[model samples]
Target: MAEKNYYDILGVKKDASDADIKKRYRKLVRQFHPDVSDDPDADNKIAEINNAYETIRDKDKRAEYDAMLDNPFASQGGAGGFGGQSAGGQSGFRWEDMKDQFGDGEAFGGGGFRFDDIFSAFGRGARGSAGAQSSGTSGGFDQFGGGFGAQDSKGQDQHAEISVDLASVYSGDDYSIKLNVPVRKPNGSVDYENKTLKIKIPKGITDGKQIRLAGQGAAGHGGGKNGDLFLKVKITHSDNIRLEGADVYQTLNIAPWEAALGDKVNVTTPTGTLGVSIPKNSKSGSNLRLKGKGIPAKHTGDLYLTLNIVNPEVNTDEAKQAYEQLKQAFADTSIHR
Candidate 1:
């Protein structure tokens, strides 16, 4: 079988811009994300897409991979050409094949051979005798092609989005999300563990704010500290209401008579229920601002009630007669004029 092309996987051209690649990756993620996608192969597709994006998105990695594609045996010396045979005398050796054979370096033992080891090996010059070419103090491929990192490093941070209810933002609440989190086993192999995390939604947290959970991301390698998980908040509100920062706007329907004659009516808002007085001869689309009733925060926001006049159906004789009287009483009032 032929090797899969990263560009083909992401559906982008070789010369695609960074923004274009990002947009394509996001689109593919939305299509294959396990939570929302109905595709049976969503999990595998997502993994493949991630691997492709991770490789090509980086300059060094992309250049290294391009070298492999252009000429698998371009590099001279002990490391070989990454094809046919490697410095370790392994035939048909390649990073992707090795990843399939030993996942997360678990096959060899804990902290054995990781997928990232490929980058550490091929992305840089081969270390000469006496470790002359080694760049970092700890982590890199040794002269003998052994993958080792003397120093433990912190894991990469992970990001996700969470939908927060507007009401919950008004009054703090708890939320839960199930994630296929990566777990580092004793054997050094990484596997996904299905776990639920409880998140505390702080009051007055605006949209696009982030909540950080420590030690919730990928496990650190070689006993390094685990990375933090960041959750971007997305405030969700009902169709009748629109939220803008700390301010809340809601549509309040009122009877035509109440709008014209002015009256006190009870209204249910995000904060609570209150009796609001309608000014005499109120018109549709007029706003009634309630002081400091918006989302609760350090700087409180105001809630605006937009009036919408609704006419009653004149089905009964009494109602029809009332409408007839109202029409006659307002007959002289030319609304268009």
Candidate 2:
């Protein structure tokens, strides 16, 4: 197969800036990510994007790739590549065919042949001599004739969920969040590492929304580009308030006397405590709306106060007398029955 151009794969110019490369990479990732895309080649496309982004995102690796693109035969692991036989060697052996003949043919005890093992089989002196030629020159081919390009420094971007309190969502504050991201090495092994980041919570941010942080993810390989961090916001229930869209709701308890007569009572809102007027003859379960006092947004919503009437203790002589007087006043009324 022919080598692919990293810049073309990422839809960027050869001289594209790091930020431009990242933007294009993210757009492609979203389109080709396996979890979201059902394209037959989505996985392959993602890998290609990752590889290309890794190569071009770094100055050194990109320069090396550009050099290799100018001259394909400049890399180590010779021109025929990967599974071909070395020229002028005895036994008419191909690396893949040799792997089939010997159970230990693969690199590092696998069925495949390792480049280093192939070099060792040819003798260390021969390998050293090959390296000496390729080491100093910009386009000199190595023993394997494959490119010895630098890896990407910025690793793959990872996604995770972050939990935020309702207060934080309502008030819009900065929160410290910790996440465990998976790091994969070039050899295909994976490990988890913990990272703490401070994220700014935007006001009126709904649950299940996603926030993106650039270059705050895993380290890249071979000096490639670093990955991005995605934070999915989740809000827990609050004790004082209930969230409904951009609106907030709470219940306020009022004394029987206060409910019957008009009064100004202190009510708590998400922003602060404020006094609200209850009209005379205000019945239990009355809802009072405090305008523009709810969650912060371009245009604020109202805070609702549902009134719950509470009866005073009748243990006191004055309270008992007042109740008796009220009862006597309604003695002729059949409404109680």
- Find the candidate with the highest lDDT and give its number: 1
Go through the candidates in order and give each one's C-alpha lDDT: 0.70, 0.63
Residues 1-337, candidate 2, lDDT per residue (tens digit)?
1143567677888778899899998899788776678897765676667666666675775776666455533333221211112221232223444445555434555646676565565433443232323233211233333334333235767688888877677788898877776565554223467877888999888767788898777766534456788888877765646777667778888987788788998876666779889888888787888887776666677788888888888998998999999889779978633
Q: After aligning candidate 1 to the native by TM-score, how far in Å is the CA of 59 from where it should be?
A: 8.2
lDDT of model 1 at position 292: 96
Superposed Cα RMSD, model 1: 11.7
Model 2: worst 10 consecutive residues (lDDT sum): 79-88
Clashes per candidate (backbone, < 3 Å): 0, 28
Off by over 4 Å in 1: 1-153, 186-188
